[model samples]
Target: MRYLWYLLPWQFSPAVLTVCVLTVALYLRGLLMLKRNGAPVGFWRPFVFFLGLAVSYAVLQTYFDFLAQHSFWVHCLQQLILHHLGPALIVLSGPVLVLREGLPRAGRTGAPRVLREMRLDWLRKPLRLAWRTLQHPLIAPLLFVGLIFFWLIPRVHFATMIDTRRYLLMNWSMFADGLLFWWVILAPKEEQGSAAVGYKVRLLILPFISMTQIVIGAYISLVPWQLYPIYALCGRALAISPMLDQQIGGLLTWIPGAMMSLVGVIVVLRHMMREEEAQLRMSPLRAETPGSSRPSAEVA
Candidate 1:
């Protein structure tokens, strides 16, 4: 326990703190409105959201951040938490549904109404365009895969580590993209609608996306030379050598990261099966076609 304490330093990042606080506040406000309106708000939704925020804080503001700065494996662990697990939990919580439901109706006079008015359609054009692009079947999966490759380029990865702005950009982009990718996979059928990627397409694409992670991970793990020179040069915080650390990082990306996509695939498969069963149930029972012996078709 004492050793664990030493591993987790109490670091305060104002920016990260602010974001977490605001996210919690908004979620709480929405939850309260949902309850007041007699909406069926589940306890699990808020729990999942808070859990994600906690994971993000742990990665960004705690000793994890310190270790990540020195250890490639630790950094990979941080990235996985931030970009895969945390974002998946947050998306599952359905923050967009909560926020949309929480907002006041137009022409109403209240803080909620004022906030609603602040949406500013013109200001949202770029964001809307980006969202639409992300929702595209091909674009979302490709972007997810591309982002992994793009940042892994030694020069790009090292540059991000050295520059504060670039580091922040990298982290934010990872989190945002992760959220979007998972959202496409997990959002309800009605929510996905015709505009977004069809369920079957997403399921089909998932394996390919997962394979990319596996390939990247295998490459990093097997390569004899260190890809990121900074990690090699820096004094390692842990006893592991830089080369071993790189291998461990590669393994992390290869295994758990690929598993993340497999989990999505499983979810989609189950959903599709349920939909098929439902359709089977809902289909009208067909009358026996001119059969002399059969009276009527049994009800489904």
Candidate 2:
């Protein structure tokens, strides 16, 4: 029983539980359906999808969340997983088609109908406009970097640290923004069509994100006084001094954030290379037959 406590949620949230459960159920059911239809539901993608979901859930729901509340470094790690690692993995898994397939036929058909019948169809145009605005190439990256800085503001951080609703909102915003930003960066332009941001543009945006994180993390680490004293009052789960806690948290934010951007650059390079290879393959080959009059140097 004592050991069982380790698995229980530090603070239960019905909403989080529902979202996680539904996500898993939908994915698994869709995966099964895809397998039946021979839709090439590969092992790695499902494994990665589940791994991302598991890590995200672990950070938010398990006893680890209790430590996160009382330790700055823990919180930083939690946010890293929630806002970066988890979302990146999930996006890489290419779960969109599977999740769509997982939906009930009634739901797939009736959702838009229900919205129109409810007279909320009027909202679609404005909602799409808002999405387009937020998803603008420039705005998306800026918002992604801005959220990291915003939640770290001392006063704002303090408020979120103590207030459950605000805290949840902060976490959710990071996660949702992460999904949006990574999708823009990683999805093939072919899929996104006109909305797609080019790999070259994403390369530029990633560095911008890294520099801002470095600036803030350096500030937090170098400050003589504690930037986040809330952990001290919360009965720090770790035995480290406040300064050490702050520094560790700062390092976590600084190092991992920058590394994530670097990794993004590498992924972008791979995408560019893949496209180049495809183009080369498709380009007409000039094979010279023995009867063809081609210079030896040119043929070589």
Candidate 3:
């Protein structure tokens, strides 16, 4: 019973619960529909997606949130889930594909018609245009890196921790931006239209952002002074000294955060390799190995 109590929300939000439940129900429905059609709806993707969603929710609603508020390192760990690991896992699961089909037929087909009838059709183009602009390769990398620095500013970080509204807003922005950034980095180019960024561009962006994290992290970890004094004010959950807490937080920001970038690069490279293999398989003439004496052969 004590263990079960820890699973409950520390400060329950009906809106968060509704969104999470709705998505789970919709995803399950979509899975059933796909299975009925003999589409290959595998086990792992849905599992990963749910796990990702659960992690984000856990940090916010579980006893973890209480610990996070009182400890700088725990807070950084919470941010990592909300901003990196959770969103990356969610995107990798292909939720967009399932969620689209999960919608009712009327909702899918009649949405445009209803919008037109309501004289809100003009909103569609502008929304799409805005999305494209935001997802632009250059802009995306900037925003992804910039947001981290923005929130890390000692003053801003202090205010965000103390104020409930700002705290909620900060969490929301982190999750949303994370989704957008990871989708750009990981989504297969073959399935994408204009949203597909070049592999080279994504590769470049990941390293740059990772380096930025390392720089900031090293500074924080090595600095003699306490960068964020809010934990001291609020009283730390852990018994460690303030410097130790700050150093641990800096290491978390340095290591796992940059690790996400490394993982993103590997995913991108795999996508590139798969696409190349596909092209080679489809083409009759193939490039011969440099060391092989045999000439290029026709593929079956």
Candidate 4:
């Protein structure tokens, strides 16, 4: 039991703590603003948003952090949750909408107005460019896949594990990219107009992305030799054999990661179907059909 306790990675990360606190603060501020304005804030929005934050803190700041550093399989599981599940929940929580509505209204005179104007001026151009770039159907998925490949390179992966800065960068980048990719796919209808890539295009490209992840995971799992030297050089802290650990990691990435991508594909398909149904309902031909009972239908 003491050995197990020794194995636990309980080191505090100031960076992780700061980030988690900021996330909660920002979200709470938005919720407060929403309530002040008499907006109907659903219970689930805050719940899911906070859940994502909690998952992030769990993996980065708790015992899971130690396990991830020591075990290949645990690291893979961490990535899956951080890059796929956690971000999905955050996006679903509708932070963008909440934040937008939460912003104070600008007025002709006062410090609040001045602050608001300055904030808008500072944010407008850069935010617009970022939004445009992310909205491109190919950009988010390609960047996401590219990041996975980039980090999986033996040298890159080893560097990240050895260097604290690099490790933080890897985790934060994956989280940010995950949020962007999922938000592109699952944004509310009012925001869909800003997306450069239509739902059909997003749907078409998703399968290819899923296939790439599967291929990468399969390669890692099937290889006879270990790709990462650090895992071998640094003794395995857990009971599992290095080879078995590598295989488990590969399978986790191959299966659960692909499943998350599949969920995005399903969302896109549903959105397309809904749009098609709406279009059909609004069609003049449908309204004028012989079976229709309205006066306009009878005139037709």
For model 2, residues 1-300, the per-residue Cα lDDT tens digits are 998898899999898899999999999989988989988688899999999889988998889999999999999999999889999888888888789789987555544576786689988778767777777889998898899999999999999999999999998999889888888887766655446677789899899889988998888888999889899987999899999999999998899988999888888898878765655555424222334432321211
- What's model 3's TM-score? 0.91
Model 3 regions lying over 4 Å from their true place: 110-118, 286-300
Each candidate: what lDDT? Answer: 0.77, 0.84, 0.85, 0.77
- Give the per-residue lDDT digits (tens) of candidate 3, residues 1-300: 999999998778787889889999999888888888889579999999999999999998889988888899998899999999999999999887788678887655654676786789998788778788778998887888788888889999999999988888888899889988888898887545556687888999999889999987888888999999999999888999999999999999999999999899899999878766775665525423434322212121
Better of 1 and 3 by lDDT: 3
Clashes of each: 0, 0, 0, 0
RMSD of each: 6.2, 6.5, 4.6, 6.1
**Alpha carbon deviation, residue 35, candidate 4 (Å):** 3.7
What's the CA error at residue 196 for candidate 4, in Å? 4.3
- What's the lDDT of the predicted structure labeled candidate 4? 0.77
Ranked by TM-score, the better of candidates 2 and 4 is 2
Global local distance difference test of model 3: 0.85
Q: Looking at candidate 2, what is the lDDT of residue 152? A: 92
Candidate 4 lDDT by residue in tens digits, 1-300? 766764444777777778777667766777888788798687998888889878867887777888888899899999888888888988877787676554445432443456566776666567668787876787888988888888888899999989988988999898889888887777655455545456777777778778889998998999999887687678776898788889998998898888887888777787767655654576757645656643322221
lDDT of 1: 0.77
Predicted model with the maximum TM-score? 3
TM-score list, all predictions: 0.83, 0.89, 0.91, 0.82
Candidate with better TM-score, 1 vs 3: 3
Q: After superposing candidate 2, which stretches have Cα over 4 Å from the reference?
A: 106-120, 283-300
